[model samples]
Each structure stands twice: as structure tokens, then as C-alpha cells.
Target chain A: MLRTVLTAAIALAPMAASAAEVVSAVLRIERERPAPISRLELPAGDEGFMGALLATRDNETTGGFLGHTYVLHKAAALPEDATAALDDLIEQGARFIVTLAEADDLLALADHAAGRDVLLLNVSAPDDRLRGVDCRANVLHATPSRRMLADGLAQYLLWKRWDRWALVHGSHPRDREKAEALRAAARRFGARIVSELAFEDTGGARRSDTGHVLVQRQIPGLMQGLREHDVVVVADESQVFGVHMPYRGWTARPVAGDAGLRATAWHPAHEGFGATQLQRRFEALAGRRMTDLDYEAWVALRAVSEAVTRTDTADLATVLAHLLSDDFELAAFKGMPLSFRPWSRQLRQAVILGDGFTVVSISPQEEFLHQRTRLDTLGVDEAESACPL
Target chain B: MRGFLAGAVALLALGPVAAWAQVVFVTNEKGNSVTRIDVATLEVIDTVPVGQRPRGITISNDGRQLFVAASDDDTVQVFDPETMRLIHTLPSGPDPEQFVLHPSGNPLFIANEDDNLVTVVDVVTRRALAEIPVGIEPEGMGISPDGRVLVNTSETTNMAHFIDTETFKIFHNTLVDSRPRVAEFTRDGSLLFVSAEIGGTVSVIDPASGEIVHTIRFAVPGVTPEALQPVGVRVTADGSRVFVALGPANRVAVVDGRTFEVKNYLLVGQRVWQLAFTPDERYLFTTNGNSNDVSVIDVAAERVIKSIPVGDQPWGVVVSPN
Candidate 1:
């Protein structure tokens, strides 16, 4: 979606000098092996990698005039140990890397790249720990933390006067973490959690015809004993049971969290603040709807690209310094210019609340006030973040 | 043809009185009406219901017609300014947020926000001439002083597409700040100022070179940067000062055109969306969406002299050519 025009300074430069002066920056995308199949339907394209490719194209549109050449190297289907692949990319002069890996794998890569001037951008994992006590100096996160997602949704629910929530979560580690964050958000936002229940993912084929019958019987039973609540918040990151609880809940309350009205980093239905142009461009490029992972990956790469284009250099130290500075701001069509939190390195962005068809609203509601930036209202602020860096 | 002839006759009938009295039209999005303000007396002279969600508005080059982009209705309703009557409706593409008329007075270029297309319509015939594909969320439209190059600022793409008027081809694209909502060409057409609502900066771009020469940032004490969203831009005829409507900040920043430094911040009403100037350039009027009012500023005094109440959510404003 990026269009560029050669600057007068660059256009007037001697052809020979310009040819020799192009600065090259290689971006590496490191992805671990696919996790075990859950109920989540996989996108047709490689989510994170496809996003990086689109970003590469977008960056190249303006990169040439700045004497910059961007190269993308994707490492996918890596074995359990991706140390060798990381080393190979580093050897190939890739100081910037976008990792579509889990927290443990990302930490391992950070350890491997320590003291090597390598900056890793986390675009997949939303682990709160990465932005908390386990934060790394060289790692920046584009993905919203689970706490951020929970707070975003809570802000909207509170705005709508839906203060009481029935919490239902699946039996998964991430699901537990998401539920914990939601509980924290409820406490912070003055909302009451009426009841809590855990839905164990009993092993079964999800698409079976009889599975619908079982879900219809099981979901209502799970909701039967819950106290009166204005909304049902489902925390099923494993995607096992959340989608089924929407209309099938015993009480006809609105559903939120992982299904029904959901809070996400990006949604195809978002058209406000000119997101329609981004959606159209992404559709033209990828031939599919842009997913949250794609948007995260694009933001990560764009951060690096913005840094390089502004600084007019490919030096890792300079780019990293500029990125961490207050002057660095990336406009990502989120109704606000996105910046990194120096403490958590989490990109501050607007969380979109959307159904499948249309965006219901955006978080950081008008009522959620912050002293510095309203975007700080959605996630951990510098004053409250546990990260020492 | 009939509408134009009737408008001409109406103009002839009100000739001397209308010439002396300048009127400003403000479109209220929520009220679905246009509020007319008399410049000499600074009063709400009339309120005419137009269509649904009327936002973008402008006067025809001849001063006889007013075009209002009723976004919800997806039509540009033209009205006779003198008689205050709806004349015709042109087929504007979906979600027409903003548009500009070509200097020749025949074609109207509109930014179709939902469809990512700039639709060109012959205002006289009310026939769509062409639909030029641009970037996402085209919201702001600007034409060069000579009327050769048309500028469309795409909100999402954050780029100003300089399209050739004759061919309707995008000759050059200059990337600006995020969520650009308005584009205004200096009177001389030497420079183009694009206001980025989210970025809170005004990018001054050179039209011929297609380069962003300077970026002007705003900072008001006690106002958060997030609330300093720049939505509307206006440059003086002499290009001495530039005024930017800071959306939620409830102020208009006046910057020195030569130095690009903020000279003064004139306090207005809440959520100021757009501005217009009197014919003699003695006064300026701002449409405040949240306050449902318009603030009148004396150009020489550089201060708001009066705040006149208008329809609900008054968004766009335009002054009659006469």
C-alpha cells in the first residue's frame, strides 16, 4: 500500500554514486514448527510470514530513495531447536528478526542473539511474562499482551454498562492466563465477575455432525448454574469451546473475548480511520483477509522500516536507538500513531472490537482517560509495568 | 440546464443585496441540515434540511450553487444559495466524505471513503465521468491553483495522490502522516498542506517535486498529543499564515507560513472539524462538531470574536463566492 516518489536530493545524485550507496538491511522471520491442531481453522497462507512479505514490499516502495534495500529471509518448519537457523540468518547479516514462535522459543532465540546487536520482534506470542519480569532489552512485542486484550474488552463492556460477566474458560495454559488477565481487568475496571467455570476440552472431532448435538447439550448445561450476568466472557485461546458458547449459552447474553464480539489486533471488518484502504490493499496483495497475526508481523517490520527510512541508515545500533527514542512513531491506521513502550517494548495501538461482519467499536473508549496517551489506558502503563528495562 | 437558468435568474433578482451580504453554509452531520450564517451580522439566518449525514460541503465556482456531500445518502445535493432550495443531486460514490470542484467549473472530484475510489462527476449533467482507483479511505480533495493537478488524500494509505485532471491518472503520490483528513493547496499552488488527524502534524508538500518539504507539529500546554488531532487546514491567500483545526483540542492553531512556527492558538469550541473564510478575508469561521456551534475569528485580530449556535454536529463549512 506504500507509494513512493524519489526525493530531489536522491534524484539529483550521480547515478554511479547512487548505485554504490544503497544501504541494505536484511530482515529474518523465524517461525517454529506448527503447534498441535486445535479447533482453530488455519489461514490459507502463512500468516506471519505473508505479513512480513507484504511489509517488505511496502518498505521497498520508499526504501529505494533512502538508499535502502530490504531483504526478507523466512525460516519456517524449523526443528525443535532453531538455534542453527538463527545463527545462519545472523551470519547472513540479519540484525532484525521477527519471531512467530512461542514464548519459550522466543526466549531461546533472544538468548542465542544476546550481545550480538540482534533485535527480535515478537509478533505471535501474547504472553504477559514477556512484557513483565521476563522482558528482554533487545526484544520488542507487536502482539498485544493477554492483559491488554482483556483490558480492551473490559473497557468496552463497561462503556456499554455491561458490568457483570460470567467467566468461562477452556482447560489450556493460555486459556488460564487469558482468564486471569480478564479477572484482573474486571477488578481494575470496577466490573463484577459473577461466576467462573472451566470447560475441559474432551477429545473429539470438532466437525462431526454429532459434535453439534453434543455441544448444543453441553454448552447450555455449563451455563445453567451461573449467576445473573450481563455478558459471557469466554477465554478459550485453544479455540476448543468458545465459538460454540455464543448463541448456545443458556442465558441470552452477549458473548465476548475469543468469540462473538471479540477484541483483536486487526479485523477485516474495521473501516474506521481509513482501515478500508489497508484492507483493500491487503486483499489485493494476499488475495485474502488480513488476520491479526499478519497485522502484528506487518507492524513489526514497519517499525524497523520506519526507523531505517527516517535515520537513512542500516546500522543496527542507530536503528535500535531511534526505535527506542520518543521521536519514533509509526502510523498504522489505528486512529493513532503507534509507539513502543520503553519499559515493556509493547507497541501501543488501538484494540478493535469487531464481530465477523462489522467493527462494533474500538477500545480506549472516550471515558478511559490517561495522563499521557489514551492508548496507555488499554495496556500496562509505564508506572505499573513490572519490566525494569 | 433548467436549474442553472433558474439559479441565474434568482442571482439577478437578489444582485445588490446578496453582493453586499456574504453568507456561510455549515453542514451538520447529525442534524441532516445546512445552517446558513450571515457574515455581516454574524447570525443564523436560515436552517435548510438537505439529506442524511451531510458532512463535506462547498460552493460552486459561480457562487450560485452549494454542493453538500450527504454521506449517508451517498449523493451530493446541490442547492441554490440565493433561494435556499435544493436544485439537484449528483451520484457520489459510497461514503463521499469530501470533494473539490475543478476550476473549470464543470467537473467535481469526490473522495469515496468506503470504496477507495475518487469519483469524477459532471456537476451540470449530474453524470459520473470517471472513477479513479486510489489508496484506501480517500477523504480529502485538493486542486492546484491552475486546476491542472488534483490532489486526493487517502486516510489509510497516508498518501496524497496527485492526479492529472485531463487523464484522471495518478501522476505522483507523496506519503504524509497517518490518517490524513484534509488537503489544502496554498493560494499560489506552490505548496500543499495535508493534515494528519492521528499523527497530529501538517505536512507541507511541494506539488511539482512531490516531496514533503516540512512537517509542522503542534503542542499546546495541558493538551495531550493524542487529542491534538489535525483535521482541517487552511492557508491564507497571501500565504502568510496557515490555520489548522485541532479536532478535540477545541482550538485552531495559526502558523506562520514562512517560518512554519505556531504563532497563536485561538480557542474555539469542542471538536472543531472545518473552517471557511469570508470573501474579503477579514474573518474566518470554524465548524465545531461537538459544541454544535461556529466560532467566528477576525483575521486582523487573530482571535475568536463570536460563537454562533448551529445545528447538531456541524462538520463542513463553505462561504458563498459572491
Candidate 2:
């Protein structure tokens, strides 16, 4: 299944001598192993952290002209000095850093890497300030914004006529911001928030004894008889009480948001449309499985690889220039061709909708017409984004 | 002159009558049913109820008995060609999805999906003689013409496991891309064509060495790569053209047998899973499970000449005897 084109990039013609020299771009990713964001469980079969890096690298390096390679530095959150380690990685010839970390942590790292000409990519963060008024010039994002995920979920809800929603939010800045996005989507799609309830994550021992009974009482009590709304949207990103909201704990009405209906980056059933081959290849190389982090790594690598394949050399400037140009076509195993947003350098792609084991649909949806592609409808359009650089 | 006229008349009377060549049988998966139709008349002649989820089907070499692998029932339901009755049942391996008959008409080779094994059964006794372990989710089964090797394609591990029929040992494990569902060896035993449903391409691999030499990519807009997948494949009698049933693409893609290059698409019914040809190689038939219809294609014309209505959710289909 492994098909290598084996391009002879070193033996090119003499006309391109004045052009940018081929510099090997190394991207070092610092993150947790087997990280779970929303519903994408990593290091499983098909896709995982390192596997994703290679997929993107392989895709971008297809023509072999671009000399960008992603080197992943994965470690658990408890054991390592993430910031110093990233600095050490940069000293070791890596000029780009992609991190799957807390919003504050990533911002600190980005600020530390500032003035050094090193770009820091925040793969998964819901911090509004990143894309809002406080966006950075060198920092890029591969994960869909919280607003985008909410809108992606709400489009289908709007389509299904589940207009009346009882909003339940967890106690977190990110969770509240996500709720704001949901509220905005609700307003835009003609949905009504009948009531708002806050579920504070009071950390205690694993609530195995009285958890189910307590959840049953609190959830049903908050909703008050179940007919008040068509859907109960829970915004709990901390994994606190999200799983307990379905079936017996919550209102009999169908659950949306974090647990019941989730929007994610990848799933196991995405094998159709030649995804399986990429997944299989990655799995074969990496003994452990792939995750969403792997996918982010993959996209980053692919971006560079694509530039090399399309342009003259594996030069950093040419690769960057090609990526910034509109003619760039990157295939990142999402069953479609993808392009980046000009303003924020955010990659526009489809968000997968899931309910436990079954994959429901991909959002931005097939019908979200935006003239050329429906994938354009997934994230912030160029006109709406505030990032000037 | 009177004696010569009498001899010519005797010779004319001695010739055999032409056998029927326009019939196709479709097996319904959920309905546990088999529908027989006259290809020329475009009519359902009979519908016989069989066992659970009848998937793999093949006609006996003599064309008298139709063998259907009833997976849930753990047996191959044998039907009488003329009456369309449940004549008998052949004991198959655990969870059979596909089966192939020996060239000598003595044994039946079956690919058991759940067990990851291929069972060789004695045709006369309807008993499994040997069960050889292959790979994960072994679905498609086919035998080489010279009766030397039996091939099984596994879905999960993405490999085609070739078994030496005499020793019943897995001699070669050819790693394909991903989710390889079906396999068929060329008539001359030179090439083994395996279709990967997930890979969305048919790989032409060497059966002896388990090396892939050629891969054909199938693509069309408005259709997913999953749908453009090559599943059931059949080569022409002359070995010039290969017809691959593109699952859910609603077409049978024709490829040059020698070059392994796709020629054109032959539009068929929806979700076309399996194919069968008549004894004379004049007509080709395919079962479209989703549309619940059987398409009869004129082999020479390369088009769906007629559609025969069949039972619900037809999966495995084959041609019976004259």
C-alpha cells in the first residue's frame, strides 16, 4: 500500500539558482500522549499522534521539492518541562512549534518564542482571544474554533427543527465561550434558549456510589418535566458529568453538545473515500494508534509537503509563499481538498458529527453552499476574521 | 443419389438441441431467499426461501446444484436447478461469506469471515474436510484454474492469503492496502486480482510471490471513493476484458485484461455486489442489493440490456445450469 514517488529534487535545472535555497523545515510538536479532546480518543487504531504527522508529511512531500519535516516531541503533561523542552527543540534546528496544551500554556510558549522568528501553532484551543482582538502574527491554528464547532452542531439542529434548547453549561472560561457560540448559533438559526443551568464540576472521589442517583435527581429537576425543550445542550469540556447526562440521568429528551452529539476531527469509520489506506499506512508504521493530535501534526506536515511538491525547492520561503498563495491544494485525509484562511492562517475543514459509536454526518454540511466548496462554511470567513496579518 | 440423401438426413437428426443460456439467479440476504429469472423473458420464474443471510453463491461445475453459503445457519443450502427446491445442504465452515467449487467438482472452498479460516469440503458427502487459518475477516474466496491454489482476501489486515490446495497450508500472505474484501486469480494463474473496498482500487498482485505489480484507481465526481470501489470482478472468456462491479457507484467498470487499464463504465443497478455469467459466456448478470433488481447485461454490447425484479436485499448471485 505504500506508494513512494521518489522525486529527484536535488538534480533540478539551473534556472532556479537565485530562488530560495532548500532549507529543511523541522516542526516540533509538544503535547500529551493519548490526549482526549471532545470525542477523538488518540493512540487508537487507524490514527494517532505520530501517525498524523507522517500522513501530512507524506502528502506534502509527494513531489519531494519542499524540504519540510515534522518531528514530534510527545510526552505526558505530568513529567516534563514543556516550555524549556520546546526551547531545547528549537535550539536543535526546529524553527516551528505546534503544541496541544492549555490555552494559557500555549500563549506563554508563543510569547516566549516571539521575536525569535519561530512560529508556534496552537492545534486545539478554544480561547476566543487567540482569533479575536488578541491574535498573534506568527501563531497559527489547525483546530476549528469553538464558535465553528458550535455552529457546525447547530446547523443540523436547525435543520432538524430542534429549535427549543435548554442550555446547560459547565464552570470554565472555555466552556462559557463555547456556550456563547452556541447562543450565537441559536440566534442565527432561529432557535430559542428556554432556560440556562450551570453544572459546577465539584471535584471529589470517583462518584461511583451516589453519582447515578444524584445525577438523575439534579438533571430531571433542572429540566422540570422534559416537555419544556426539544433538546438539552450540555457544554462540559472537562468530561465532568457529560457522559452521565444521557439515557437515565438527564431529561428524556435527546442530548446534544459534548457527549450525546459531538463534533470532532476524526473517527474510525472515516475509512471510506481512500481514508483507510492512509490510516492503515500510519498504523503499520506506528505500533501504537493515531489520535487528533496526530492529525494536526499530519496537516502541518502536509502543508509544507504540498508546497514542496507544487513549487520549486524545499526552501522555507518558497514553501511559506506557496502555502499563503490561493493556488495551494492540500489533501489532509479529510476526504476533500483543503485550503487555509488568509487572515488567521486557520485551516478550513469539515467537523465530524458523532453519537458514541456511529458517525452521524460531517458538518459545514454538503448543502452549506459557499459558491466553490462547502468546507468554506466550516470556519470563520475571511471577511469576518479580525486578524490583519 | 438416394443413398447420399438418406445419410445426410441421419446426420442432421443426430445433432444436439441448443441449451438455455439466458438465466440468472439472485440470492436475497435478509429475506433468506433466492429468485430465479429468465434473462431473455425478463421475468421471475421462481422464488425459493432458504437459510439466513445467504451471501456467497456458486453453481456446481455440472450446473445441476446451486450452492449458497447460509452464514447464520452454518450450512450451504443446495438447490435443485430445475425445480428451485431445497434439495440438500452442504456443511460449511464457521460463518462463510464466499465459496468456490473445485475444477474437478469434488470439493468446495469457502471463506469463513468470522472464523478467519478457509474450509475445504467434500462435495459428495457435504462435509468439511480441512479448515486452514488465513487472516482477519477472510471474505472473498476463489480457486486457481489448475486446481493448485485457493486464495482468500482479508478485510481488516489488508492482505490476500493464498493456500496451497494439496497441502492446505497458507504459503503466501500478500499485504494489500486496507480492507481488501474480494480476490480472484486469472484463468492462467499468472495474476491474482484483489479488490480493496476501503482502498477504492483493485490491486493486481502476483499470487506466487505475493508482490503487487499494478494498481488501478477508480474515481468519479459526486460519488465517494467508497462507492467507486471495485468489488466483484469477472474476466471475459477470451481473457481480453475484465469487468469489475463498482459497489454503490451504479456501474461495472471494464478494464483491459492484459494491460489492466480501465476502458469504460457499464451502468448497472444500485449497490451492485456480485456478478455471474451464463454457461455459454453470452450474457452477464449482476445483483443490485439496494435497488432489489438483477441486471442482465449483453456481454458483447457492454450495456445493461434488461433488469429483472427480485427479492429484497439481494447479496450473492450466480448463474445456474442449462
Candidate 3:
């Protein structure tokens, strides 16, 4: 009789099986690059712009605990397919989408993921607009915001007593946003921008075809009438002319912008609390040191793991509620805990100032440090966020 | 006069002239300081600042010099053991992480991780005599009993590369696990132990054949692999007991040397990295790198009888030869 009853129950178990907890994720690599290129110094896929996104998936899921099995789906993106690709990810049962793209791609993904119970995690792109007026509820930024990066630079500048600055801007939207963010931070921290200069896109190689002749022709006049400033802050996020600006075009003063004192989510030498272990593991598995994009994606996956463990469920609503709540704190490789902005849902974090191989310092060196809590210093704080739930 | 000279030599051979094991050298990783402790009175003698990020330390065979590998500075610093003064600095090639002295006391072999090479430095000349390529991320180093072979463990390749000291060539590479950090051979040359920080186990390999003979697994439920990391392992002189330091687990596992079984565990401070033994083998000292304290264990009782606070991030420790 018991066997007959068990067989009947097993036959009627479709509804319960469907309700069993499961989480689906989509890893989207929205990058535009030529065929993968190899520099002699690095590996085959090391130098390509697209490889940064492809390498991100290498850090996603491990240990396989909490009944969570993540599925990653890859999509190659040009500049145009940002919106439709993110929508396709949501339709394919991905409650979370991690993207490696720029400001325009993030804006499109933010709209697509909004109100859909799907979180769009941006691993690349450091435009302040995404964390400011353009911030959204469904979008969760894994990378440190542009404002945080600027703040970090400003703190070091203030510490070094570089109280005067000359701001230079480039043609791209990324450059404009970075300059504006730096300007706002300087205004708040009492560092004055003495002068401003703008560089044309020129549309070709990074270096001037005319070379030193062109730089000698243009820079003296642009910087001719300037007063004594401590440093020159150049915003060339497009990498078009940031390298050219240093030691060649600019004046004799030291530059502290994209080229000299860069602010980013991660650096190889930022050996803080868990960074050594994470970096060691990343190097072991990925066969190379981790970059900023890879680090952000890893943190996004960690946030997912933490939420799943805390909520004890993979259901979209439950996980979203926990992530939005104030009690969430993520212990990342940054040596400090991170949390979310209640309004914008951007994860608050510090940006490390990088000089290529080494990290010079972290922002908010404990003075301009303003926070509703420590996590609020990353992006727009809870009290000031304009994002609507 | 001849009889008096022989008597004085006998007295000198019998013991130290005075009680001179007063200061223990505690190597600091981040603070860049070497703490000195008076073990007899349990007082911190002095915290002397040193070169950047010193990790491993070894007292000279004569006990007159202490060599510390300041990794960040890429040099080995020599200090007067009696005066505690920075007497001399020796270039250890690029990124020297650990060092092991030759038994004959003529040269020092350094494991340079950044260059992936082991540098043999002439003690008197203080110059690198030879550089031999090893595995990737070469860290812990040990010399064989016969002093003819040296073993260096690479963390990334997870292998023990045996270097022939005479030829300065890699004899063999024995793969152990995910991240093998350190390797040490038993005094009798019977067993070689390699610690895999990520693998959560130490592998015992036979030096002659480069074969893993035994695997010792360490684990505690609910604690992650990051916590149960086994870093430093030292065997007693009589080969009766083996002590292994578990990184964040904050405990040292005392294993039965003959049976290869864990006998008991002694709780220590946090993030235990390097450990040492008194020359008499009666007490074991562990440098708790995170807690800034050195835990002194009574080996016979298998308990940490005392904890002495030291410099910031106390890392490596070595007993004085005298």
C-alpha cells in the first residue's frame, strides 16, 4: 500500500519540481574589437579589447554551493546591439546580466533591465552619468563609479598639496564625463581649476601624424598665459591622446589624469586583505594577472553568492529584496566592506589610483570621507540618490 | 700553559659563555620591522625597523649574523646578532623571498620569485655567484642533509624543483597540488614535505625518486579552504613529532613523525605563518603574522603555554644557534 501511495505522489510532483529553487545568469561581453591580437610580451588574447570581456567569465562561479548553478551565455556586441542583446538575455531566463561595455551600452542595458526583476551588472565603463542623473533601479554597477575615481585622485592631490589644477578635455563622451566629475570634486574639495583646454578627436592614430612638430606648434599657445598650477589634470579616457599628452605636448608640470594618475577598479599591486589570495587564484586559473573588468565581474558574482546565501533562495523577488535592503555588506578584495545605494542600486566602492603596474593610493584617504555609512562613499549615497525604485 | 688552554677550549665547547638567547627575531611582513624578544624573561627587547617586507630569516652557523630577505627591497639584510645593528646589506638579485644557508657556511642560496631563479651568493664576497632557473613563483627553500641538493617549491606550478647545488641545475620537478608554497626536507633525508596553501594538504615525497609517498589532509567543517591553509612545517630533531602551522585556522597540528598521524593540536594566534624550535627541542615558537604575537608551545604538553606580543605582522622566526 505504501509503495502504491508513493508512486501516486511521485506522479503528482510536477508543481513542486517546478518550484524548486534555481538561478539563471547570463554573461554578456559587449565589446567591439578586431580579430584577437597577441603582443609578443603577453599571451595571444591579452591585448585585444574584446579579450577583457572574454576573460571576465573565467572568474564567475566556484565551489557550487547554495543550490546555485549559474549558466553563462556569450554574445559578441558591436556598438549597436546593446539593447536587443540585453533583452534577449532577460527573455532567456537570466535574472542577472553582467556586461562589459561603455556608457552608451550601459544606458541601453539599464533601460532594458528596469522593472523586469533582472539586474544589469556593468563591469566596464566608468562614466559618472550612470551613477548620477542617468542612474536606474535595475542596474547594479560592479565597477567603481567615475565620481569615486575622481575623489580618489582629488584626495591624493589634496594630500600632496596640489591645490591648483589646469583641466583638459577630449572629444569623447567618456572624456567629458571624467572632466566634469573631476571638476565637481575639485570644487567640493577647494582645489581650483585655473584653466581648461580641449583636444580634437583627429579620427586616426593616437599620436599626431605631425608628431613633435604639431605638439610644439599647439601646446605653447594653449598653455602660454597660464598661472602657476600644481598639476595638469587631463581627461582623455578614449586613450586617443592621453599617452601623447605626457612629457611631449604638455608643459613641464606633472600631469595627473588618465595617463599619469589613473583611477580604476583594480590594479595588480593593490595587495590588500584578500587581494593576494584572489590575485593568486586568478593568475592560477586565468593564466594571467586579473584586470579591472575581471575584478568587477568577480565581485558581481560574489555579491550574487552572498545574496543567495543570505536570502536562502534563488527566487528573483527574494534576492532583489535582500540586495536592496540596507543590511547587505560585501567583503571584497578592497580590504573594506561594500554595500548598495538604496536609490540607484549601485555598489559603493573605492577606486584605486593606478600608475600602470602599481596602485599609488585609494580615494577618500580618510579626510574628505563623507558617508551615511562607509559604503555610501562609492557612488551616490542613499540620502542623495535620485534613482527611483 | 698548555693544560690551561685545553681547559678553556673544553669550557667553551660545553656551553655559551653567558645566557645570550635573550632576543628572538620576529620578521614582519607589512610593518617592515623585526621584533626582538627575551624568551627567558618573556619581555620584548626591542622592535627594530628593517628593509621592506622581510619574510624569511636564518641565523648564521656561527650565530654572529642574522640574514633576512626583505622581498620588497630585493636584498638580504645582515644584522649583528649581539648588537642588533644593521651591519651589512647584500644584494639577493630581484625579489628574494626566502633564503637557506649552506651547511658548510660558505654561501647562501636565495629563492627569487620575480626572476624565477635561485641565486647562490658568496658569503664573504656578498655577490651572486650563480643563478639557476626553477619553477614559477618559487617561495620556500630547503637544503638537503648532504648539502648537495636544494629544493624550491613554486606556488603557481605547484611543484618542488630539486636543484643540484654543485651543478646549479634543476634535477627534477615533482608536482604536488594547486599552490605549493613551501618545501622542507627531514633531517635524515628520508622524507620531503611540501605545503600547498590552496590545496589544504601537505605532500610528503621521496627525494630520491621524486614520488609522493604520503598526503596529509587538514580540514575543519564550515571553514573555507582559505582558512585551513597549511604553510610552515617543522620536524623535531629526534623525528618524533611534526608541527604544521594552519594559516587562518589559528591552530598548529602536531603530527606523529614515525606514524605520519596527527597526534594533537595546539591553538595559537591568528594567521600563523612561520615556526621554529629551540635548539634543545623543548619549546616551539610560532610567529602569528596577523596577531603580532609569538606563541610559545610546551612541546611535551602539546599546549601553547604563553603568548608574547611582538611587532606588527610578526612573520618568520628562527632560534639562535648559540
Choose the strongest candidate by lDDT: 1
Write the residue-wise lDDT of candidate 1 on B46-134 in tens digits. Answer: 78888998989998777888999998888899988877688989988777889999988879999987666888888987778778877
lDDT of 3 by residue, B44-66 (tens): 66777899988889888778889
TM-score preference between candidates 1 and 3, better one: 1
Native contacts matched by each model: 0.18, 0.00, 0.00
lDDT of candidate 3 over A69-178, digit per residue (tens)? 45555555565766777667667777766677777767776776667778777777676667767877677777877777787788789888998998888888778988
Fnat of candidate 3 is 0.00
lDDT of 3 at A294: 71
User: What is the lDDT of every predicted structure here?
Assistant: 0.82, 0.68, 0.70
Name the candidate that leads on DockQ: 1
Per-candidate TM vs. native? 0.78, 0.61, 0.57
Error of 2 at A230 (Å): 5.0
**For residues A1-389, what per-residue lDDT tens digits would candidate 1 score against the true structure?**
01221111212111111221222222333443334333345556577777887777766644543345778887753535577777877777677888878888888878878888678889888999999989998899999999888999999999999999999998989899999999999998999999999989786655664667777898898899999999999998887778888899898999999889889999888866556566766787888888998888888888887777666666778888888888888878786789888889999988999987789988889888888788988777787889987
- Every model's DockQ: 0.21, 0.03, 0.03
